[model samples]
Target chain A: MTEDKKSVCKPTVFEELYKKHSKDVFNFMFYKTGSKANAEDLLQEAFVKLWKNCEKVAYEKAKSFLFTVSSNLFLNEKKHEKVVHKYIENQNKSSYKDNDTPENVLRQKEFQDKLNNAIASLSEKQREVFLMSRIDKKKYAEIAETLGISVKAVEKRMHNALVILRDKIGKI
Target chain B: MKTEDNIENKDIFLAKWIAGEISDSELKKLVSEEDFNVFQEIKNQSEHLSVPNFDTDKNFSAIKQKLETPKKKSKVIPLWMYAAAASVVIMISFFLFKTSSTVIQTSFGEQRIVMLADSSEVILNAKSKLTYQPELWKFERKLKLEGEGYFKVKKGSTFTVETENGSVTVLGTQFDVNTSDDFFKVVCYEGKVSVKQQNKEVILTQSDAYQNIQNEITTWNSKNEAPTWINGEISFEKTPLKIVFESLEKQFDISIENKTSSNKLFTGTLSNTNLELALQTLTSAMQLKYTISGKNITITE
Candidate 1:
């Protein structure tokens, strides 16, 4: 379906697939590396790959195929020996942590505190796939395709990841 | 809810609950139980996760500017080291070009802005594609776009953008093309654009759209409105039924068909109505019916 993805004139089918998958792949990588800068770079890199081989990608399977490529690229990038520039530490907390209220402020602050630490403690794969699927709103099927796993496996993994996170995150 | 029997049904219940397919009574029962606590915990955790949608306008613009700058002169090396240095240069250039070109791609519902050979820019909307052929760009300033793209061609002697539908030849022009679906439309924004659709040729100035309607060629003048949903709003005045559905299809990324072919002639002027309202208005006006599930929007007589 995307055979002419490399064609100069028309918009290829793979582009639509990339638009659908970029957020999922980037968020997955971001949650894994715990760095926004790295996630952005990785996302851009993953898209470049999709454009090159767009001809092989069918419209029906583009979503899954993109994820698979993203996950692979992210994993390879993570297996680096040399360290480059350090990530810019998030000195200023995101406004997301600040709730507007004098009464619930204390509780919201406490909730934020727990979330910060709990999120840091999840295993690599668990955190990466979980956040990609949950936080980025990617479907389980997309996550599974990116990780080269079955949908059932993705479901099980997501549920397990959620369970671990639920036990540790928030004020439940 | 914590009973062994209830525990056995939890997964099925959870799936149904997420989809909102559970009966009201069943939902009420579940809400009143301890399992609801677990569900609440999951929701709380979910709420804490934040998505930071960063804008890369600066990065994109800076890269584009660099691409547009005229070529700089390279320093010459000694002739004795020419063979070795040339081979080294070739290898390095090849590696850099390959890595950059192969690293990014787009899918349906995705658009990317790319810096072309001439330094003029193109914004690809969803379901559109742009590819960079760096090494071969010097010979012919050419780039490929699939799906659809809005091109702001920079002023240059020779610059052209290609698509499966046709080729737009121009030195500099601002134009938008819808190339993803079966139909291909070109709307010139600023300068003139000559659009070549295979054997059939069409040229469009600014604010004009070259569209093929039901196998008969037709051109839409400035009076005929262009699609503008990408800016998060749509304005239609006295637009036909088929065109309205086409624009809506791009916005919702779903198909809306008039299968019965009963009221092929539909006229409406819509602005800022919700998608459902728009659908309802069109369906009611034409006395047509539709069934929607997932991404599928099927229409009937």
Candidate 2:
């Protein structure tokens, strides 16, 4: 029954899609831009775009459209100015650094700093693939579809990302 | 050996493992491999990398608001046409305002307190939503409810609460109404309340609990000021296992998959604060085994 009804995108269907996929899209944006506010804004823009073009997009393709739109929006914003520094600044100001033992807090701060630096050193494409795989938990094929690349390419990028991260965070 | 072939194979296994899709034999094979410790360490470190919690409700509401706002235009029209457009706009806005209602909703493992226009207090239970029109409060004090709520209506007009299965009407009373997929219950704590279900009307005064299970109406006595859910515990009496588990899901925000045919009736009490203890209490009483992974729980006999 749902298969037959998949052709026409009703408001209720759109809402269900939103409720199901919005978290994944938001996490994707969060990984792209390490700012919660920016991620939230991009998520809204992406879903609003999908809502406006719902007639053209099938229920099956909405997730890819959302990811593509959100990633493009992040890239466009990056083209205007460098936002990585701001991301790091916001990371330092995050609430994760509180209410722990002094030694443990210091260790956590050092670990977080090193991890962010390691992620920052990766190539843009590798970073995107890695984050989509690890953070968003997207399938390789889905990531490939969203980025308009082959599944093999996604695998290669993910492998490169892991190699770099392993080398950077050595012996941990 | 950490050769390219081994690394590639390990990466494939690691991906499958992280996705929780790896078979047991494949997992054993991966664990037996030489560079398995390296992959394990990387996975552990990667899991510690934190992402900020995204407030889905807040962002979704923002998107809905943006969708509601009309796009701007920069065209100029004649004065007469402008007057006609203004009247049309006024009419549309008026109708929109008339139909607009205030909604109070609570997600799983959450509860909320809502004060209506007439100062009637309503305590919404977990996984519930209550919608009412403030504009029509004076003439028609009515509310539409889903899930469960405890209402304390101030004495004035006839206040009514409507659900999918039935409707409850009262002049001034304190009562509890629960409307789920397969259950409809109304428990009157104070004053007189009338419940109408499928052309059958049942009126109760105090300490009366009316339940309709599979279209079978049952009445009992509950001598309490409010429902047991308000006291941080949920007490059930001869309820089906499925309904009890559904309530547990709502109270804990967990997905429960019942693998066995649990046709047994359970009469037990569980605390909402401690999840592990609650699960222990429930599963032990039902003589079932359960496993929990993250927020998902699967129960079996």
Which prediction has the highest DockQ against the true structure?
Answer: 2
Between which residue pairs do clashes occur in model 2?
A: none
The interface root-mean-square deviations, each candidate in sequence, come to 5.9, 5.0
Candidate 2 chain B: 10-residue stretch with minimal lDDT: B85-94
TM-score of only chain B in every candidate structure? 0.53, 0.68
- The numbered model that scores best in lDDT is 2
Q: List ranges where model 2 is wrong by over 4 Å.
A: A1-172, B1-99
**Scored by CA lDDT, what does every candidate get?**
0.53, 0.70
**Model 2 Cα lDDT, one tens digit per residue, B60-123:** 8877655543233211122222111000000000001112465656778777666666777677
lDDT digits (tens) for residues A3-112 of candidate 1:
64343112443344545556666666567666667766766655555554556655555656656766677678773223231222223344334555765655555655
By TM-score, the best candidate is 2
Q: Kindly provide the TM-score of model 1 when superposed on the true structure, using C-alpha atoms.
A: 0.41
Backbone atom clashes (below 3 Å) for every candidate: 38, 0
Candidate 1 Cα outliers beyond 4 Å, as residue runs: A1-172, B1-111, B180-182, B223-227, B234-247, B255-258, B262-274, B284-287
The single-chain TM-score for chain B of candidate 1 is 0.53
